[model samples]
Target: MRTVFVQIGEIMTRTPVLVAGAGLSGLSTAVFLGMHGTPALVVERHESTSTHPKARGQQTHTMEALRLVGLEDAFVAASPKSRGFALRIAASASGPVFHEILHDTFVPMGHLSPAASADASQEAAERLLLGRARELGADVRFSTELVSFEQDSDGVTAVLRDLRTGEESTVEAEYLVGADGHRSPVRTALGIGTHGSGSIAHNVLWGIRADLGHVVGEEQVLYYLQNPELSGGTGVLVSTDDADRFVVGVGFDPDTQHLDDFTPERAVEQIRIATGVPDLEVEILDRAPVETGMYVADRFSSGRAHLVGDAAHTMPPQGGMGGNTAILDGFYLAWKLAAVLRGEAGPGLLDSHDAERRPVGEWIATNQYRNAMVRTGARYDGPPPVEDPATLFFGYRHNGAVVSEPGDEHELLEDPNAPTGRPGSRAPHVVLDSPDGPLSTIELFGREFVVLTGSEEWERAAKSVAADLGVRLTAHRIGDGLTGPWAEPYGVSDDGAVLVRPDRFIAWRSPGPGPATDLERALRSVLAR
Candidate 1:
């Protein structure tokens, strides 16, 4: 409902937000910004969306975020329905399975949230996001690059070049988002430093056409082939959305061999050996070398410029967290930037981006790097224990944009199953019966700040505060038109209240009805007003 479509100007250039790189993060930032009534100008150096089935699998947390922009159905329909994912230690798809590291089922998480997890490929996901972003009035241009940008207290001035015409233009924006890839020119211009394990391995990614469904099964498959006969001692094979298409990553030492050394013929032979099937018909569609590494930027924002996705953090794609995290980074920034641009929040609210996302990014990068090392037999201190998937998915907490109770210890993560509804935590999902139909409480956020209460007085206070502050805010009574058992899950009583941010994170909570000034104070603090 917060979606506000502005008329597209023929020669328009200025925007409130200028997003660089049309990857998942940049596109998502543009899409979410539009949803919050602040469409962005998105530019990408590449000519078009990626054709490669690069990253796959959208976790529950990501699905929830995508649902905010009504992308859940499209994404779920685009991907394959899977019982879950399977990671096995084997020579190849056709070879004997040496060990099974993880075999998960997707059905168990049905009650945790309203959105369904998806195995959608990055290629499909990007197309959907681009379409939605444009429909919401975003001006997304391809073959355009962000040449440089300078930011002062008021706004950002950026130079952009058309890759095709080689003509350059200047644009002004209230804020700039650097969603570029790992080698980010925007980040470089910002002088942002990175810290973590650098380039762990060099791998040649090969696109192959083969009927591996019979060998790999229908579920998502991750085959870790430890065959010394391959170029490197190890190799990885993953299944894509297409039944007959697959991606094979073969590692190689840059010191001895190069990407050029792995010719089409050599690649076929290597795939044959890894599959343990001699004379297997295989056609190489494409091949490119990629370097895997672990790194996190020291800062996520600088002045009016900010970083997201690989520009902010880079980690091995062992768990597909990088792509999901990148999308989330965009989601997190969109709302805050929208609020600041609209004068609903102070500029100081933007500073919270680094405090909220950097720690979570570091944890994910470090753990994923450790996981990659173990899977590849690379040296590490030891194989660190992986946190529960649910914890990693929904349990991560935030430190910014929240007014916590005085005694709150501020744990980074909590058991989502035993959600306490503390400030900075994700709002727990609860089924609510309404005139339309049954809906999860998760469906109630994203457009504007929301206050939930069963008390009429609190609802009145919420409405008064919104008018007094001149900000977009909504109040919903639990038992009025909506009937449900939400008080327990929200950690509030019948007369208590819960404040949820636009991103659906709990910003504050009260155990019982409070003075009229209570809700106003909480909103002011959360908005950095």
Candidate 2:
């Protein structure tokens, strides 16, 4: 059938930032731009919210980004707290054995919370973000399709079709962001080619509501079932949100099996066999089959158009990096766009978005492939697990960007036993006494650049620099006994300082007083001062 067209009459005087797609990535970009006083128009082909929870989990970094957009409390309220991830290995004689537990001690939420609470946090966060976006007046047009676009020096003009009304219209915007999914039409229209492999295998994901308390002992469980081929086995077990509900993910060769082969009966049998719980009762809520694949765009930006999230990079879901990476992309791009629009920075600030983020996407893609290999019992052929020092949490670097020092080498500091504040890593999460009560160091994040220092002089210097550069800088004093939980993780005593970017990554840090030149240089680099 020929696609219907929806016309937006009369071009808006304000150069609306046009966004194609209303998925998490598109919604997030629209929200941030709208909050920053920029007008945004987002078009989604889907008629409504996705019934399938394509991305069910959000990483800690995702949480930080949501918090930055003032939606953390809401997100926490919606979803349950995911404290830990457990892997279960299916055995032949013994049947199954609990393998490993990756404690959620990374940051913000930490490992103290239970699985149900974590889930609640996830739900709350999503609701808050969507609601806030609406409140901010983002023009979220659902059931709208982007037919095509033409760009010039002035702006980009896009033709969008309304699926319901069968009308077409044009939208002109100074910038166009393609927050569309992996099969992004904008990327296709831009002639962007993806570099990576397609799904190595097909997997079915289903959510079940059952009182599986007897079968699964933990609040959060991930089972790795053994198949006859010695490839990856089926994945089954309880999710972090609903205690009585479970999510089962199973791998199958789509070339051999048809969709009918993944029926609820077959899925149930697979779950029972994988978990070694023959009598377990599960009520299926929803099911979806997905083909796993990984890919990164050859380029993320072309002129006024840029890609984020799945459009920029599509990774296997093994590491749960998809949503987190997308959110980070939004925050990273938001400030740069703001800087350029407000005349605080030059267009060069936009170049760093791709340079800094592409490496991150590469890292996530590599880790995701590794996780997938581990799941599929493949050769484990992905990049070596980032050395302890470069664990997914802290190992990410901005390279020669804002705060990177020349000749600074990255060392492996993955010491679960080591103190916090290690070099080339995320500053440890700390708790400090706030006027209301105790607050997390993560709470101080978001909005603008934050300089966490111990001395008033340092705080004063930071404020001065911020004023000189026409940027917002928040300085927090790390008082004695004030470090709370963050001291050990951050490796900071009372004498150190940390410069956190708007995106929550550590820009520059020092054990004690140092020349402000580095901080200035880093900010200049990022802001294009």
Candidate 3:
């Protein structure tokens, strides 16, 4: 059968997916879909990827998601050589020996994942993702914009305009993803509302190029230079790709400070004052005319169109959760979309995307807001002292309809340090010796449901069930392949089985031995058979 549709007399170009925006989230979504052979068309208003060095934190969980699709190496190679992040609380960059707050080396908590958290400017990361998307046969069109879209039960029809030629066209797509940044037109058209601390505070960002080698005696990714004595101002001097390039951040008061007056000369003065480099003269590369805020949409989807990235949630730059979380959003939803398109899952499976990611988005927004509060010295009245960052990163669960009914009321988050193979939680990583070489359990996921058991009998049963379903499911016997205490972390017995989703989140589990029919029944329910 032909993989397209027709409307009236026009032969409408039918695509599996339509991605609005060519930024990081949108590009990543296209790349993931293209890799899975799901044709996608991505439209962006901008002529090219961003050159502004905005977000710089690539968290561990985000890296793991990228690694799943063979894109980790590119990120690592482009990211800054930041071993770990440190909040260097100093009187000034050139002076002072105040208390420097440093944390443990950045790694996924409990060694739960094989991928490492990284540091790279958002601009750099986007360039990499955009290339990969185009390489994977994605139809990415720059200087193009999605004017509007009409969603029906079967597909979405989006109006497109070529910004360069004033040409207009209509495209039919199975689904639409609005990866557009904040102030998303798609979300606005869908009438999605956002809630949370609206405008927390205002901060001005200025990019600069200078020699701060002497000022920064030690190598640090971020420097919170607090110099109250300076007549200019104090904020942060963030390292970008090299020592010469940095983005200068400072509080902006619209009432007193006029953006037009804060020119390159003024920015240079602030940089000099903040760094305590008396005669430091630096070029002000660029500055943001607007400010940043924190918020999450009340709804993730409106009919056949769904929002991702800044369209779904906007958070502070703290914890570097902005871009990282957006990337994860694409990774989480990509495989589900592919599965549904391939008819392996019912359309109901798509509902799991919002059920799983919305809460996580809200949580990240809240935490980042709190982190912003602490940074700006604002009174934070939320969770006292803040929850562990680990729980914020790797601990989120998909409490949605895609998984089987939980045996118990599992928490919204699992402890990354001591992961239990519980429903909704991410599957723990363990390395095993395969004929090709050593491979991580995480490496086994991404493309299909994985049923891992310690007992050979359970493994055979899992294989039989998968064969009957004719789904992209597989089984593995960890103990037989020779491994560590694999079953313990999963809270499974020799005969117990753990059913993992394609996204690496647990779908169901048998704490101990159970009948083979029980496994089959659970699988059928989760798959919506």
Model 1, stretches more than 4 Å misplaced? 1-12, 81-84, 104-107
**What TM-score would candidate 3 get against the native?**
0.91
Model 3 off-target regions past 4 Å?
Answer: 1-12, 81-85, 89-92, 95-99, 103-110, 225-234, 255-257, 384-389, 402-407, 433-438, 479-482, 513-516
| Per-candidate local distance difference test | 0.87, 0.65, 0.77
lDDT, candidate 3, 1-529, per-residue tens? 1164436455355778999998889998988887677868899999999988778767777887778667788777887664455666555666573555554336444366767666667888999888888888788889999998898888898888999999878888999999999899999999999998898656677888888877653365565555665322347767777768878777677767778777777777777777778798788887885566888998998787888999999987766688888888888888878878888777877777788889888988888887766654556766642457677777877888444454657457767777877788888877677777777788778777888888787888888887887777888887666565677878787678888887888888887788878888877777666
Summarize candidate 2's per-residue lDDT along 1-529 as a digit string, tens digits. Answer: 0111334366332355788877777778877776666657788898865554445555555656665566756665555444455555554212545444244423343532111112332233434555677777777778999889988867788888989998877776777899888888889989999887666667777777766666554446555555562214555344646677666666766778776877677777766655556766767788777777888888888887889989999998665567667766776787667657766677677777677777778778867777767754667555654423225644465543355545556433344334344333455555577666877776776667788877676777788888888887888876644445443465454566778866665777666676777667767876766
Question: Which residue ranges in model 2 land beyond 4 Å of their true spot?
Answer: 1-16, 80-85, 91-95, 98-117, 120-126, 205-214, 217-220, 229-249, 260-287, 381-390, 409-444, 450-469, 474-500, 506-523
Clash number for each model = 0, 47, 0
TM value for model 1: 0.95
Would you list the clashing residue pairs of candidate 1?
A: none
TM-scores for all predictions: 0.95, 0.77, 0.91
Report the lDDT tens digits of candidate 1 across residue range 321-341: 888999999899999998998
How accurate locally is residue 8 in candidate 3, as Cα lDDT from 0 to 100? 41
Instruction: Give the range where candidate 1 is weakest over 10 consecutive residues by summed lDDT.
Output: 1-10
Task: lDDT for model 1, please.
Answer: 0.87
